[model samples]
Target chain A: MARPTIADIAERVGVSKGAVSFALNGRPGVAEATRARILQVAKEMNWRPHSAARALGGARADAVGLVIARPASTLGVEPFFAQLLSGLQAGLSRQSVAMHLMIVEDVEAETEVYRDWASAHRVDGFIIVDLKVRDPRIEVLEELGVPSVVLGGPGRHGSLSSVWADDREAMLSVADYLAALGHRRLAHVAGLPEFHHTQRRMRALRDSSRRLGLAETVSTTTDFSDAEGAAATRALLSRARRPTAIVYDSDVMALAGLGVAGEMGVRVPDELSIVAFDDSVLTRIAHPAITALSRDTFAYGRRLAEVMLALIEEPERRRDVKTATPRLVVRESTAPPGAWQGD
Target chain B: MARPTIADIAERVGVSKGAVSFALNGRPGVAEATRARILQVAKEMNWRPHSAARALGGARADAVGLVIARPASTLGVEPFFAQLLSGLQAGLSRQSVAMHLMIVEDVEAETEVYRDWASAHRVDGFIIVDLKVRDPRIEVLEELGVPSVVLGGPGRHGSLSSVWADDREAMLSVADYLAALGHRRLAHVAGLPEFHHTQRRMRALRDSSRRLGLAETVSTTTDFSDAEGAAATRALLSRARRPTAIVYDSDVMALAGLGVAGEMGVRVPDELSIVAFDDSVLTRIAHPAITALSRDTFAYGRRLAEVMLALIEEPERRRDVKTATPRLVVRESTAPPGAWQGD
Candidate 1:
């Protein structure tokens, strides 16, 4: 008969993989009864630890864990991750470290994943992204004693190191550029308001709009889907007093906005100037080649991975990295508000 | 002293973590001399396998492997993967199976991954994508005695089960619809030619175009980047005898084509109709709501995962799944040739 695996033992014991891992590792988290049951089942199955598995003896796995808590629908369309992953892989590959990725639906489930990987020693460390205002995962990871590097900011992570792009400054540049182009009324099609960076960018936009003395700046929240982006555009365009310029948090949203504008017979640049936050292929390929706050996302990921490795190898060497400010790339989508007076 | 880790041994021996895994497991892939040295070093370090890893034995890891060999930049913006991944996760989560994802650059490197994962017993089976004309990974996977499910057609896989969409039928539908719309001269922006589905779709397009007695049907290859799509579109549009309609392999490419059309003073659906494959939010949100070959991508992913799990559980069950035929969604992007007589 084939040797028994972890799944078999867990199934027999009526416990989770995490629970089994904890019990086997003699980790304190598992209940005494549960541990005993798991041990008994494992022994009955005649499951002997593979010699290779035995040789490591509490050694590092030389791997890092990354868990994303978002709907797959949102995760798939967002270019942010793909670019970041590439950069992360580039850096991690240098150290031959494996990246174990898991996608969960919420903070609670994501926390569970952390526990599972931690108890198993499946990963030496972690790289966290899309940090919330009061992220629960931070505390859980801390308790696990696993090193982690947050992508957004370090403010709420206790002592965890962070890497961030000055999105606030980038937003300011976007608002200032739009205002300079004689755009009075403006709209901001923003991402999920819960994320730290989204909140920062929105705050920057509101502050900059107030300072610019613009007539109004209406902001709408979205799940970062193209459908929501179009709906937001439609709602903003149907307004009694419509905005002349609109800034989107992502290139996909901006492209959707462009499509909405076209459908509504709004001439881009002349009637409704558009600005996108990230400069992705979508922005570059758009009709007017959308104006955007561009930064090297690949480099951002690579830097975070480098920091993660450092944190894992030397827990005391906590450091923060501030990515270069996003530069505004002026494209065909932006123009003086009254350039085409006929409209 | 701290517990000896895999990283330290790898560093000392100047070999890879994969090599160490092979050597310690008594796996035949490692050289005899290298294996001897690895065992010696592991003994000297007083490294014994962690109980957590050892408990796994010859048991199922409750995980399946997925490897994507693509340029990260292209992978990031492509909506197809994101949508599919959601489905895969949905199906796998239901079965409590973990999906282990790896991104590699080429087929050879991809083969190495299959070997490593197989030797380590990290995954029970694999779900392969981007199947080439004569895939090397198939042979290696078979040799490793690991069950696998291919995402493309099963024809070239030497007995491996597969799950695929009827892309050929979909391509034919696309051609038939465009022909009915009175578009004779046509252009198709295709994905990487190495993939079996790309070749099949191309063949179907050519056959249907010939059967329909079209004036000409020219095709261009792209790496699926919007830039390449736009370049292909530009080259096609600049032709003296330009096709009235263009079909793109992906929505991102079609969006790029739209931008090129706008720049070249061509109006979509009026002067030049556009059709995009694999309907995405970009297609739905586009100005004219681009005509596309639509399919349930999430469902596709879910089904593939389900099949992978089945393959792992019952290696004797070699089933082929044909994903539902893509329905042609006629949006505003396609119309009779020169519908705008003025143009």
Candidate 2:
């Protein structure tokens, strides 16, 4: 626990504490070489200026702020946030940005969260998530003039820059893959209908299935959770003729489908071909690995961070509709309908 | 984007701005009914007290802090933390604590990080993780008087309280189950050497295996990741006479191990029985569902949060060691050697 203070480093380097502070803060007054030297000494001494300390100087603070509103429980279960956060951290690591992540339970709470954070200068910017059917955070962020990036696709909130996955394409690809395997009946396990992305993806899956001239079956669940996924699977399997393939909105639910299949004495791929959106390992270990619309979760995180950085550094930059093509990984779980096909 | 503001609420309520602030901040001295009227007006106007406004008082902010020295690329891939976080969020919901999660590239960087956050009060306390050998954070945390709880078991840090699974009991239980099933050649796919929990868990696994009179085999990996787990499985299977059963540190690795079995045409339970610690869906979905040492990840998380809260509420309270016992979940993945085995 030998934490070397800035004072100790300033004393060793023979610099005024103010000069050291300026250098540590990356202020323009310090010479580049001198700043580099101070940084080097700080590194050697393992000195890390606090986030709370940095924010105190001016607009920066005893506080670090981010604009987020969603049930904390919902966000925690979603792998999307986890992956994006990993990416966000990667970008923030080069600098000293202590994030203050808030979990406002509803739209009403999000409206005031922005004002409070900005008033206290507690946050640097908002990391807007789950852009809603009528997201008010964008208006609040813009009115407050806080730097932020929308984490979903281009929305009615016209002015903000955005980073989002192509959920429509991801869903379309899943349907297309299942249809190609000579499966006429397909089912989609979708997320909460209220979420903008979920609605978009469900629409895409249904439209794609219609285009493929296949039987399109869609079931909606409030949660993108494994337990709900299992329940959906149970419903699908209980029918007189189950769909040859089922597509899930999340890996958690897709993982649950495997259990439902076992309990129902249904063989994966043979009796029930299953495909999911995530290519995570949960799908891989199942007997006959599930064919999936796979995207790199790590890459998703990295891309989100990149867009956030762009939002922070070049605020005026035109918001781009950056899309990642959800690539499909054809694993063992998807095979041509060999048995248990609905006529 | 019509985010309502405090001013909007005050105008609607016809109240002084200070009164609105007082009522919203939950400060005393406001008439109870008047506060009720203000809250109702705020709710009617859909007003949110901007999070930035939270910075008006003390140095200790509303955000909780988390530091992980593990690389960002790896952290995103881990399901354990994701699940634990979900549980933590459930607990945090009870108190409304938002967390600042950071993933630094190395230990020294992480050390400086804690110092910065502590001094600046970026977070009132921290949920310290990945307990390493000779941890120095305990003293630093003590000096700062920050509320902290370690994720792994008690380590070189003597004072900080910890939350962990009963590694010894988990090991003993797994060994007993396997032994009862008549497995003689037992192997453990242990995690990294430097991780404090890994050492304890591995030591216990070996000791228990020896006591059971099984031919104990051990393989070590530097990562508690899926890729390493698969590689370890492949190495074990490639051996001319592989052990009857193999144990994995995590569910992801076990999933990858299942993949190796498929690739090698080695049957599970019959040819290469497996048991994994830390139950999550990866192991749950294996074709022959992996029988695992299922400790409720959600429960573990809620329990961890409760302990941290206890520590925070009464810092003078003596630090206690709390552990969750692992219960056997006998899914399709485990069976007696050559009895109901995959082979």
Candidate 3:
């Protein structure tokens, strides 16, 4: 399908394609978001840019690289990457940069992929997704002296620029919403234990429950999906002290929890409240729309472009920028309890 | 991230990236699917045969010109493209072909994008989505000798190759399923009136209902979204003689109907029954899994690749080929109407 080209991107962003062209070519003109979406589509088209000053040269085969040692299965289910990639692509597209995707089975493979892309000049820079408790990629990328951006801040603190979202506030909002709904006992179906965000969300949720004067229990899932969400939800609902609410690390998990509630004969917002992270369209139209923290993946895309450019322009200042704020959107899935419960 | 490189593609498909490169060059492949995916992905990566030939290669822009021809707003909300494009990408990824997308606001602009791409060699071919009774694009493409594929067949028995799910068979399956469930009355939520598939499905449904000895009522929607589907569903349910079952052109529509049933105080598969098309993940996980006529979009993509190549290779024999066949996937959404309405 012939879609809106740079000309359309230019029109929407209120500029010329040449201006769009200049911004995309890593020159300047047009706001960051407009440039990002153009870049995103350009990447989607696998469009490449050459900075050799030939003006719209061609593919370098040296794409921008991303290395996260997570399971390919896990990455597929995670909304963070889904949205983040969407954002990254948006930003990269305008620049006509290509993303060469690879899924390593483990950390060793991840490092290997990173080392190879670097030595082979397969990528100009790397866009790192997750930073581990002690992520080795940072050291590897630094040692290689290849340009890159970590998706997370230097945990414990560092010189690397990171694009971080506040899951803590988002979790606290979930707890606050459930507590206000008169729920005493609550449970959170979190993501894998090792993830940086999972820990942050779990800790924030526990603190929020205590702060809100509500009782809480927590469950961790190695897999963030509807199957695990359903299983976790079932365990909570079947207990003598069943939780009045449940929060999920993913919208997919939250979606699964809906069916689990249906299976246990529990009614949403009436018998139990539900909250999900990543307010995607899937969450918005869920039978009883789950309350969620809203972060625009599309806008997340815009910001990724900004940080990438900073890394390109002022590599020293890249880490100083903050990209997004996670905010809460209350919907039909969360409400006061027992109105439809089997009490 | 280093994924399967063109070298990997050459190895897997059992050809050299040069031969894989040449076949990908659209010279000829060892077989059909092999060359198609390579060419597609080559187009996607915006890869060219000669790096030095960047001034403009011997071929076109590699875009499969798509003219929405409908209002842009209507196209965005319809998940058809989202899912369809996902399939299209899956198929094209093998060949590395990416579409140069454009949303034409007028008929002339629509025709111009094609001419510009064709004349300036901007696109290798065109992909016409949402076909009408006597699509003008077909005539235009024929005159241009441009290689193209239609998502839906034109009504006039044209000599163009098509890759469409058998909507007629799917509609009849819905009627037969309802009849076997002992439902005497049925309604269909067909898509846009001018759409060829919608017309085909509606006519088949009316005929099938009569054959099954049941009365039929059909409603049409310009928007093929869950929202409109739900609204149409609500209108039918509110009627004095509401049908016992509802069939929809898409799973999205069926999902909307599910919400409508819930809002109308109708318990699904009890007071009402539902069936849908496109057995997406949503249908599988819906509270009661939805019954549907499922077609593999993945396979559809792969085959579309084959057909497009055929059009490329033997343009004189472009009049043959159907890529997808609709099949029944029975699930929880269809059942007898209570214990009283037995078959």
Candidate 4:
């Protein structure tokens, strides 16, 4: 069967094609009763506007682009990304905007996608995540002149609007909590070093350690995978003098580190303590219920979508918003350091 | 700077507008050297084909649509979805095809989206997941005459291509494994009852119990959320004559059930056994490490993308490809029932 067009609807409703077009576009010059009749006939005939034709008439794409440059294997297991995605969808779907998503190889490929989508007008705006130190995407987005929202940053976005949580404060709170529990020897399993948030977290730990006159503090970087998280934990525990407390950058990694501790006969909260930087179902349902920095990631994503929509509607009104700081939620995982256990 | 145009590229290359067009479209009309020079000039000027114009010329959208009808909050925690999404991106990105995604309210909203996207020609094809027992979208898609691949089905998709795993056989294997482990009274915590795969799994356990002469087999349904999964488990364990072994439809639910058992002083693999229908890092890192039915979900997603691409390229070559059935991987979570543990 042939696709129903405006002409078909017009004929069925005993109206002119021009009147049907005006009714469908919700423009003036059509009577209210006639518009309703036209719409009913159109729905009955299953008529839909050709999006390309609408695009030619300067209609909005009604979609946003999210290009992630990360390993797919790691992404699947990480609740952070999934929850954020769900949240972003929740916010965008309310406004009838879809998300055009892609996973690219690296920053360079990601920039190319931005250029392509910008030129094609495939999306109304872009939502950028995983902000890095001296990020290159910011400059590219600036040059493209596209309305965008950076998911990370209190600063360093260079005029781009952003929605960020206080990562440094969150990390410092964790360090303070562990230090008060007499954990002088501290260690951190961090994510990729290039990310701004990772640097903030590492610096927070170092500053806190120096202020507290701690014996030793170390930060090891990984690719944010469970394998790397477990390996990092193994290396830390294998030392002749292992730290009494360790913090992981993500819940998946934290859980893996907990498993490593179990395998090595290190009783959590006794000889050693563990904390996760992010909280999800994984952290809550674990055997000992891992201690974690808790924040609502789904709500964060919704806030991001809200920011993007606002920016797109009024690109001239740039805003930098800071969200609530994540609070440390102590569970069954932390305690005062016991006498040093030799390897 | 204003957007670059083909005419501007033609002027720079000192070629006719027709020659520039031919070279840009990869049509054989311009000489090889001239074509290369035109391409170089076009790239230097950052020229891109306007997608709307290309669409009017009958070019492919270079995208696929995936409209999900589940709640966004539940979706974020499900590893099965996150893994499949990653895999689908891995496959589609290989060919530079983006996934246009939307989360809608229900089946009616989802079908409306299908019709809108199909009529708009905004995607090359559609990838449908979570097939229903009496799906209405299948006929809508058939009437639209759009190329599509159903991710669930051994049958029931009329005149459409499908790539499915043997859900019934996979469930049978799980039931057999539990029955052989000396578990008699079995209960299943299932996903939404309307889903075809859920029905298959529930029926498999029922048939297996009758054949194996097991006592008191039952299946309870939920909306596939950790909250509901926990509530269902709580109700089951509170019974005077609780089942010796329980199977959960997802890893998150299984983990939640483990936590509940701990809260209730039920020893896993001793007084009660647990099995999850899916597996991921959640199962692996759990203290007791849940026994689960496992499949390579990422690879399954890639396979779906491949099949959708094939169906789009040659719509006449309809195929119902069967992928490998998921296998049961026993972990520390399941064992024989020890002398009845009275509530």
Q: Please list the Cα RMSD from the true structure of every candidate, rounded to 1 decimal place.
A: 13.1, 5.8, 11.6, 2.8
Q: Against the true structure, candidate 4 has what lDDT?
A: 0.90
Error of 1 at B108 (Å): 1.4
Over 4 Å off, model 2:
A1-57, A61-78, A176-183, A209-222, A234-244, A261-272, A338-343, B1-59, B217-221, B238-241, B338-343
Instruction: Give the alpha carbon lDDT tens digit for every residue of A21-121 in model 2.
Output: 89988788888887888889988776775544444444454223554555554554556567767777776654656566656667777666667666556
Report the C-alpha lDDT of model 4 over A86-185, residue by residue, as the tens digit.
Answer: 9999899888799998889999999999999888879889999999999999999988888999999889899899999999999999989988988888
How many clashes does the backbone of model 3 have? 30
Can you write out model 3's per-residue Cα lDDT over A22-98, one digit (the tens) per residue? 77778776678877877776655433332221212423432466654544334333445555655565466455454
Best by lDDT: 4
Docking class of 1: incorrect
Cα lDDT tens digits for candidate 1, A146-258: 88898887386777788888888988988888888788788999999888888888888889877998888878989888889999999999987789999999988999899
- Candidate 4 deviant stretches above 4 angstroms: A6-41, A339-343, B7-23, B26-40, B341-343
Per DockQ, the best of the predicted structures is 4
Model 1 stretches astray by more than 4 angstroms: A1-56, A183-186, A209-220, A226-244, A256-271, A338-343, B1-51, B218-220, B234-244, B261-267, B338-343
Question: What level of docking quality does candidate 4 show?
Answer: medium
For all the predictions, what are the DockQ values?
A: 0.16, 0.37, 0.10, 0.71
Give chain A TM for each model in order: 0.83, 0.80, 0.77, 0.93
Model 1 lDDT per residue over B1-343, tens place: 2446677888889999889888877888888899999999988765655435654555566677777777655555678877787688777766756677666778788887776666566677888888988888888777667889888873888778899888889989989988887888888999888888888888988998789998888788888888899999999999877889998999989988988898899988888999999898778766667999998898889899888888888998887888799999999999988943322
lDDT of 4 at A198: 98
Model 2 chain A poorest ten-residue lDDT run: A55-64
